[model samples]
Target: MASHQNLNFQGQIPGEFLIARIMQIHASISKLESLRPSKQVNILFSHLVKLCILPSSIDIKALPQEVQQMRQSLIILCARAESLLELEFATYLSKISLPLNDLNRFPYYENYVKLAKLEYGALIENTGVAQLKKVAFVGSGPMPLTSIILASQHMKSTHFDNIDIDETANNLARRIVSSDDEIEKRMKFLTSDIMEVKEKLGEYDCIILAALVGNEEEKAKILGHIRKYMKEGGVLLVRSAKGARAFLYPVVEEHELFDFKVLSIFHPTNDVINSVVLLRKSLIYT
Candidate 1:
């Protein structure tokens, strides 16, 4: 991890300085032919992630106007970095003859394992739902590791609907888990925008919104749709970010969650990049 001292913040928020570093990193990342598993791209992205997590006391909104203006662009870049990595890994895994039990050989597999445990623990602790019969993961992307880890390791009997708007991504996800008979039997991939499947939302006992699913307004719209259609008292695990991590991922605002009963909002201060918000659809919609 890059030390905050290296940036020389001098006891004040490095607003423009941080923006300059971000732009420099963006320029480097943009120049890459592909954000796949490469030493250069990995180092560049690691720097960007480190910059976002650097110790900072000021809220993201309080940053300079120039930095604030670049927040959305930063979020998009971060998402692209993550998506490209997943796509590359998924594509590679799909072509290989690796067994499902060997998935931990992937470099970033442990991150998903850690994240899955954190989320599953959060769900059980906050919602008291230790056994989920049906769960849906919105924007599961090319590599649906969270669902895979949860279904295989935690909730073995649960059925997971991995939803993504991109059919190619869904196909890749399906192929990645095809070797695992147990997982393949339990995981179902759906290719459609989340809003398009509002009628089927009520089937899931829990739904997880991925971090890169959408921007703030788009996420609110999706959340509203889920709130209106998901079964009463069903839990929604929303991946969010707080502190400096907000620049890497969109932060779910409190105002957008008025319709749902907000149960718990956890901001991880450790290696976990995403914060999790646990909310349950109100039994009585107002």
Candidate 2:
């Protein structure tokens, strides 16, 4: 029965149809904003998280590239929905759950690893950064994959610090990092909000900002606080924007960092249209 249903899904869920479905849900939420975040809509989002939001990595692995993109597009839609409706229905879907029975791995597992390498490489290859000896990751949620990847790449002398406002998330990230021996030796977690982070952890060559950080106002405040403490030429490896993802993962526009110079940028198409931005803290006289 399950096999038959999976086949049926593939038959109907073409690239265009999948894209349309996502747009349709987005439209519905926009039109029914008041009702969309209520209890009734929570059920709808739950179903989307369960049945539709997942990445069809295995199912569409051999399919056309376009179809594979559609599979990821669905994941993006669910992520956006969760971000928007979290206040009203925080528990509608849990953290990035592993697929049942060792199902499909992360949609872009290799791509993500590769991009993480590039983000690290950019930090090292850029002018100001010789070695990313001290790294800090902000807004690291339960699974601090970026921290793991970035931290793992460097030697033991390098240290990585990750902080999140959510205590639960901080604990989870710490546990996950501890499980991996390579990353565990260097990674540390702090349960503190980015805005309140006044500690002079010395000079961090690189600081990464997760895309899932809250709205623009909060982001500006965080940036402002960090700027006050960061050293000149200190690099910020931030997540930049792509099209409408600004609605959820508000991209740190270059304009926002009037005191920082844009170094380089990388874009990858996945759950969230993500851009790895490399920035250098600069002296701004305005």
Candidate 3:
């Protein structure tokens, strides 16, 4: 029965259809403002956290004011990094954090690793980013957005931007960051597809790509183009959605342009259905 269903999904979930499905969900959330405050907050917070309203421990208080307030209700802790905020998967947000079992929506697995102290620290250390400036992140939804904000503060050179192809994602990211006093004048937000990065290439020193779509060709195209955006010896951090690894793992292994590596793999101690991958990138062209 499961095999038959997987085959059915494979038959129907083409690239265009998958993109359209994402757009539809975006549209539904856009209209969610009409719902009651309780409902609105519920929906928005769910979307926000799922999209990665996280901060490293060191940067939590330094986060944009709006984002801090947005995260105020959630149960998160401070990590060793001045900018790092830890999400205790065993305590809160575990269900939404690890939604891999669900077939209809996109999920973030890195949140699961944030639950594991041993793995989380290793992931952060493995990033090899002693300093970061002019950071560019694709898939600025949840974990990536949090990372962009945290890394920007850690570098402190000013000028931070989290760019995404989804207008909804960009809008949500802006709303999340708009309130952070620490990020004022230091952060810029953009909504654009990663595929057209050539126009904006050479503007960033580091590029981070987190989250995976089901399409292997699209993923490779994204990775291949992202390197063009970095200066010589710049870094790229890429993480795949749990289900995407079956197809994407081999591609990452074969790709020569990126110094791709897994930073950490997170599995929710409370929820077996959810898992996340933290990976790092280094540009090889330089």
Candidate 4:
């Protein structure tokens, strides 16, 4: 499972090692930092643990037929690596300001997180005043960055609910949000499987789906639930992939369902590859 393979965020065939190296260094520093006292860092290795780096691109050619067949599994492994590394890095951010995290050097993972949140913010800001009342972010992981941004902006007058089935992640998300007074005042974390939350369906003007959620069956089930409970004309924003293999999450085409009409599609300017669909719930669900 630890076999080395060449992969890049843009599907570029870069034999480049920047992100891969950063992940290795991050894991190493995390361990090293855990051993030393913060007041008087170990003279020998203190600053070494604070290193950061970014990405570079390369070009290439055809993949073997067998490799093509295994692309999905390869992507799944990549997604898992990204999620675990991201969670670890988000934990690191807890110790200092976000800027101090040096987003450019840490751009691969951390900026991915921030842009996932900001993609929705761009839409909400354009929405008419008080139009975006209550908001729910499903599949919010340990950071709940999207919910934090919305609560601090559009949903400030109401509540921003972050729901996920993972209890540990929910707790971690709560701790992260609580650190910010404004986000804490408006954001709430709930550890409940989506199917069990009927009331949550109708409680918001908007719903943002996390990209990590699995297959078509699971998404269809959730969409069915949304059809039943979502308010008429409410917005449903889904994070998807347009032209690349994403980790554990399946790359799906724009949803073909009767309950929601495609309002527009948004791609992050950074070209992160995760596409967001802004949909409006149609009154009729067949």
RMSD of candidates 1 onward, in order: 2.8, 9.8, 15.6, 8.4
The number of clashing residue pairs in each candidate reads 0, 0, 27, 1
Model 3: per-residue Cα lDDT over 1-286, one tens digit each? 0111232442223433332332333445445433323444345434433323111112232445653333322211111110122122111222343322221121334433342333324334765544545666565542233443353334555366677666654544454444445554576667777776675757765565544431445667776666545555554555432321121121233343334444455533332222444444443322
Give the Cα lDDT of each candidate.
0.83, 0.58, 0.41, 0.57
The residue-by-residue lDDT of candidate 4 on 32-102, one tens digit each, is: 43432332223212222211111223111243454334444444444455456546655666555552223
**Tens digit of lDDT per residue, candidate 2, span 1-286?**
0221243564234544444444455455445545435565565544333333323322322446764454445445545554344322222222334212111143334545676777767776776454557888887765565666555554346788887787766665555555457667888888887777775534677788877675545677777778778777777777755433332345566577776787777755454346788777887533
Off by over 4 Å in 3: 1-129, 142-145, 148-158, 241-286
The best candidate in terms of TM-score: 1
lDDT of 4 at 8: 32
lDDT winner among the candidates? 1
Q: Which is the better candidate, 1 or 4, if ranked by TM-score?
A: 1
Answer with 1 or 3, whichever has the higher lDDT.
Answer: 1
In what order do the candidates fall by TM-score, top score first? 1, 4, 2, 3
Cα lDDT of candidate 4 equals 0.57
Segments of candidate 4 deviating more than 4 angstroms: 1-69, 93-118, 121-131, 153-158, 245-249, 284-286
Q: Which stretches of candidate 2 lie over 4 Å from their true place?
A: 1-22, 27-108, 128-130, 154-157, 244-248, 268-272, 284-286
**Which stretches of candidate 1 lie above 4 Å from their native place?**
1-20, 30-37, 284-286
Q: CA lDDT of 58 in candidate 1?
A: 42
Clashing pairs in 4: 79-247
Q: Which residue pairs show backbone clashes in model 1?
A: none
